[model samples]
Target: MEPDAPITIFGPDFPFAYDDWLTHPAGLGTVPDEALGTEVAIIGAGMAGMTAAYELMRMGLKPVVYEADRIGGRLRSEPFVEGEPEIAELGGMRFPISSRSFFHYVDTFGLRYSPFPNPLTEAAGSTVIDIGGQTLYARTLDDLPPIYREISEAWDSALERIAGFSGLQAAIAARDVTELKRRWNALVSQWDDRSFYDFLSTSTEFGSLTFRHRELFGQVGFGTGGWDSDFGNSMLEILRVVLTNCDTDQYLVVGGAEQVPHRLWTHAPQQITHWPAGTSLSSLHHGAPRAGVRSLRRLGPNRIEVTDRWGDTREFPAVIATCQAWLLSTEIDCDEALFSQDLWMALDRTRYMQSSKTFVMVDRPFWTDRDPVTGRDVLSMTLTDRLTRGTYLFDNGPDRPGVICLSYTWMSDSLKVLPHAVERRVELALAALRKIYPDLDIAEHIVGRPITVSWEDDPHFLGAFKGALPGHYRYNTRMYGHFHDQHTLPADEQGIFIAGDDVSFMPAWVEGAVQTGLNAVWGVMTHLGGRSHPDNPGPGDVYDALGPIDIGK
Candidate 1:
């Protein structure tokens, strides 16, 4: 951890208790040696690697996965208190239905889901927009200026049409960048130079309506602070995401988000080997005809050598590098130029926002303030300018009181250290609750302080996922371009294949990671005569099975 970095209860020096909790058996563990040298080698057991491994297994290929840390990478769920009815998620939470693939996977895996409570569920109906200390009234579309409202309504309608285009949907399903770009550009050109706020302001009849809409948009899209992002790009991306995931309907896994990966592993066969702890990949050596190719020695295209963390080197015909893109490009031996220089520059120009997930266990079922619109319990709340920005309230049922999980993203720049940051966040969350329910005293009702997880400082994932910048829309289509182009490496050669949300068709999210894994598998299969598992069909076949479903249809 950097000395000058912010302090939190979850930081390095905060004792290994939290670390121990994170690395528990349920967290992440290495596969035993007997499982080594399988058909494929997958590094990193996060969603991407795990999903890739699952897909590979479905294709009849059981790959050996190597993970330096716990499984589920950013999808962290831990017990706030031993013997509690439910565990708390310390990483990513709230999966929007807009992620069609993810939702399909959940359904296919037989996972259960339910809707999350709306934070505005309380009777104190007015939406509050707090900036610094001042609270402003939030306006709606009906309150907007006429001209701006008209344009916004028209633009929104147009966006909805673009999102529902069958070609765009097919392109996304196929992971075809060229096709997607052709469709996206055609749709985005309508408001190419306009900011979403500006468009809303100018297109509406009520300027106040535009301001209110921007305020809410700022809170949801870019935290509490108003976003300075390119409206055209952001709007298009948002619409595309909505259409892709079908977010008009949202759901949460009944057990928890972690259940998604658990199901994948459950579906895996027992014959698949799991490497034991302290086992290093360098110590293992394989002969020709291995399930997956291994690069061993530059000797005549048949062998290649791989050095593991323990300094042991072995040869293989092929290897899959399912690690972060930056790690795969620089740390592992690969063509640095596989990705366009502009892509790398764009990646460098972008920085992931830091987030700290804090899970709080409370004793009461507080639904006194029911939102008239959503009618669901307001378990989740987003604060405009506070240490704990978002909260997810889970109903533990009458038998057990509900638990509140508060997530704070983009906190690195606001605080000085991890410990202090967490403490301050807890204070703010408690204060916010008080503001929402003055009669409900938090200090007295508080069962435990929020347990925080800082993704920015974690060694495994240096940052959450790749974030986009103003002009980076071009690269959005290029995400995973290297993997899809089939030119990531020489035609006959194979080494490490990178897989993660950063290399997926969409932005950073669980669905992106899953898709990236599918893409990686395709790359690997293409290198091996298109031979995947005999019993299980590959992704291509899966796509074929889905048939040519039209998006708008």
Candidate 2:
């Protein structure tokens, strides 16, 4: 195990312990007898929505969940059209072990997982780093080019020197709320207004390197994939990713990541209240969620009305919107009075990263085989400066069909193929892959048609996830602490809550979604005149001492 820092209990972003709230024997909070049968409107049946619904149902409140699309939402795992028993993780493929809040559900539901096939992992078999027309195949980072080594070292040195990365990571791991706040808030104040690219260009360690080195750093980032698209984003966002180890020690669900939400919807836990012994979230919804929420309106003082796409309307004392905030203006008919002007500006300013993925099912894990002459694996997990940014290979079993993510790209690369058909997208990806392995015929091993996704084109989800821009921490704090700022909001808007990855300080992570969902649940419980257990307090319970990290202040 890594060396421990001074241990202190605090939440990941704030000082509130969301994990404790969920595991507490008393449950989140108990509503009054009158509020027992009342409904709480939950929009978007994704990870956040389902989490809130599951907890609300357990606490005796009926959550009327409305999903615009499928149950999994952005956690979609596309199965092969031919039914070859393989899946393509179009969204949210890998999960970091550090995400305790999300793993709570994974552990409770007994969902099996394995190490994701990232570069250099044993599951990856071998990695091929193709950059600047030079392709190198290796099993570990040591075998990479000297320039790549320099780039990696420079990044480490820059983080440690500029942001106190090592100490902050220790504090985060130890859950030392005091130390984390001290370190994180200081860094946020320093870097919240600085772009990630600015940090790279200004840091003495990175500045000493050549322009080629900086470009190489962007082309191939430390853990998951490249960081070029994130250059313009806030350095604070990148710091959060590194501090939380979001890119390391990752795992993928055994079957599909979507199963996490699907299982939560139907699993009947033992600590539930009001509901019968075998009750589940699906049972409360009658096995099918209501249609998509078309409009959200403030119906007088504390009553918020929700209208579904089918023209049916229902009133709830509290409403939690787990969908992307952009949909509030684009897809949903929302009353302008629901949010303050500054909050509206923040919602409009939320930037989403465009992501695209193309996957193919092959006859078997053919990549495991080695060539006779060169003695290298046939197809290796690839990271390249080519058109294909990242390529992953998934082996279900030695004999069963395998899945290959031909290309996983973001930003400009993703938008380039937004108009193309899935077949053409696959062809384009294959052509790029052929550049690295010209002699290999990837088409021959194909067992089914390819599956592709361009998240920007999906109306339900405008983009993959929020990529916080420079000076966006204030906006994030506003969104995340909306529950706490009820006194400042209009009377009609007090009962409405927003919780999702987009509203979290750590966007693009399931952990963020889960944490925010718990926040919303706490807010709704209090709005319905319920109080958190004394032993386990919600975020708002301790907001006075451990308020949000407002860099703007």
Candidate 3:
């Protein structure tokens, strides 16, 4: 914990101190001598899968990783050209400092990062809000008209009125678990069935203002850009973001976001249980992870057989599936008998949100170049109701070429251009931006090919990340708590533990994936007859007594 780490993603759902557990002097745990070097199947090579694999290896267990596309998974960063440092973050960029668990690994490796250029933040020098064919430029909220400030105030007042915002945040900052759980558990029951729009539309503050206020609020959202896309999601989901400060104090990895997981894959802990000091996941598997998984079935009692895409099959004592739960039915040939009817239903009902991002590398940080007459930068971080919902500017340095996220959108906005190729996507983005910066010819500065991504279009990732809908609390609880409850399930079902951001209450954040992965580690250790140190108890050790609220179906 850094001095007074303002806020941590410490469970409003399951308040486990994963950050503390990771930094504890006492190691994770020790497996039995006989169980040492036992192979455990790890599906997916993303942050969640890699985190679990890294810890499992430190404990002297062999983690056989299966990656479908790339090792980084959603934490993907692609370069603009052959060897240039300027890169486009295809997925999982702009991480929050409150994501203590995810940063644990990043900080361990000393990965450099800078604050993200959010809508109104200092990192984004100036911001432009264009809506209804009108444009307003400002460096801060106060610089905007009174209406913008009113909208911001109303949101704060509404949160305090309806959710006890101050006290809730105070509890979290203070790390008061008892109060945090008591306040949060109550909120879960109240807001779980309610939608985010429902919270806004029904609030006394918002209700007092006109509908246009709500619209403006959506167009110019807090922390980042417009959150209108998440309007249909559960209020609990929205509250979690603000409560944990998930939307504020965000930073981007210097080299790339993918480096966190890639480094984890090859990281060698200072003190390992059964392996040599220099041992790492890369060394264990020779170099790269196994190809994607094709099928998963129970070979015998407490034994799971996994087949790779190329028809290579192997059985392991336990399997930690870090891939999206929805993929169990679609991408992999998972045996139906592996999970219970209720668990299967939860996995099936898990909804995902679509997302799209288009990026390009420019000759220089041209946005910083001021106009001769107006003395204003040529362009500013933009948020608009147009096709391009948000346009962010990234300045590498005077020496390196700057990168621009020409457009970033979600949900229906993303699906609008789902079928388009990268070139077509860039064209659409430019067409929309031209409306605001009509005089600026963005194409003149393009140095390399444009890069774009539509997660929904990708087979491996059917959607960006989990976004729970109203009345989906029961489903989230089932998926997240599965690691702890798996012990009571039937023999065949007990060993295959599920983990990922989708399996966590705080989905769409890397910390969610990291925390859930830690949970899976505890589940696997316990399943293999291992136990955590007495002083430092794992999540599973205290989960039954203090887990998520079970708001029954």
Per lDDT, the best of the predicted structures is: 3
lDDT of 1 by residue, 255-289 (tens): 66776765665553332234333222222212111
Against the unseen true structure, what C-alpha lDDT does each candidate score? 0.50, 0.86, 0.91
Please identify model 1 stretches exceeding 4 Å from their true place.
1-38, 82-85, 118-182, 188-213, 220-236, 245-247, 269-306, 312-316, 329-350, 367-383, 411-421, 432-436, 487-495, 531-553
Candidate 2 TM-score over all chains jointly: 0.97
TM-scores of all models? 0.68, 0.97, 0.99
Model 3 Cα lDDT, one tens digit per residue, 278-304: 999999999999999999999878889
Candidate 2 backbone overlaps, count: 0
Which ten-residue region of model 1 has the weakest summed lDDT? 7-16
- TM-score, predicted candidate 3 vs. hidden true structure: 0.99
User: What root-mean-square deviation over C-alphas does model 1 reach?
Assistant: 12.0
**Sort order, TM-score high to low:** 3, 2, 1
Cα misplacement distance, residue 434 of candidate 1 (Å)? 3.6
- lDDT of candidate 2 vs native? 0.86
The candidates, ranked best first by lDDT, are 3, 2, 1
